[model samples]
Target: MRRELPGLGSDPASVRQRIEGMEQILERMFVVPGINKPVGLDVILSLIPGVGTISAAALGSYIAWEARNLGMSKWQVARMAGNIGFDMLLGAIPVIGAIPDFFFRSNTRNLRIVRKHLDKKHPGSRTLDVQATPGA
Candidate 1:
């Protein structure tokens, strides 16, 4: 039989780490030339022909689910949902939508909320940035 451990993966700090992982992939995986900021799978996926925004939003919902598990308030959770909603709604608009997706960065915004909640409730532990490749 396999056993799960406490204060490990399921704990608040671990949750923050996990959130960072998701945010790293979805929001900061790459860099654009000239502007010199990171971009991630969220924007790349948004560029897909169809079902892209939905798929990204679905992945985003996982963060909200994690927040609920972390005991965040209904308001905070709703705000996070609101962020995703805006991202998806705008992201659905085609060319113009993709442009905004490049800048909206909803995952980063949501992660900020999740990390703030964890940092407040679980003192001493700090939110850490996910490792990323250097952008050109």
Candidate 2:
């Protein structure tokens, strides 16, 4: 089994970094020219036939799971799960889901929750870094 993150429940800096890295990849890894909006692996992956939507949704769940690991409240975790669920539901549809996927940005939404909760609970943990790389 994969090892639990060190100090995940009590100290979340390292865990936050790891989760933020993942959210960065999943939510906003690329920019649209001129329009300047960003997109990422989750949106790209959902465009694939079969497997893709499910995979993106599964990967999206990791943030919520990590939040639970950090001892976030059940309500907070449930909210995170709901965001992922909405993304997944929209993503499961072909063609129509694309625009919503671009706008909804559920991974980023969930990361904000994690950050908010961490800021309240962990106190000293650095702010969550969800910004996509420039020109990516």
Candidate number with greatest TM-score = 1
Candidate 1, residue 83: lDDT: 93
Model 1 lDDT tens row, 57-105: 9988888998999899999999999999999987888756778988898
Query: What RMSD does each model have against the real structure?
Result: 3.4, 4.3
In candidate 1, where is summed lDDT lowest over 10 consecutive residues?
127-136
lDDT of 1 at 5: 60
lDDT of candidate 2 over 1-136, digit per residue (tens)? 6576564534588778868888989987877899988788898987875578889989999888888988888999999999999998888888667778888989999988988877787778876445457789
How many backbone overlaps does candidate 1 show?
A: 0
Worst 10 residues of 2 by lDDT: 2-11
lDDT of 2 at 108: 90
Among residues 3 or more apart in sequence or in different chains, the pairs in candidate 1 whose N, CA or C atoms overlap within 3 Å are none
Indicate the residue-level lDDT of 12 in model 1.
77
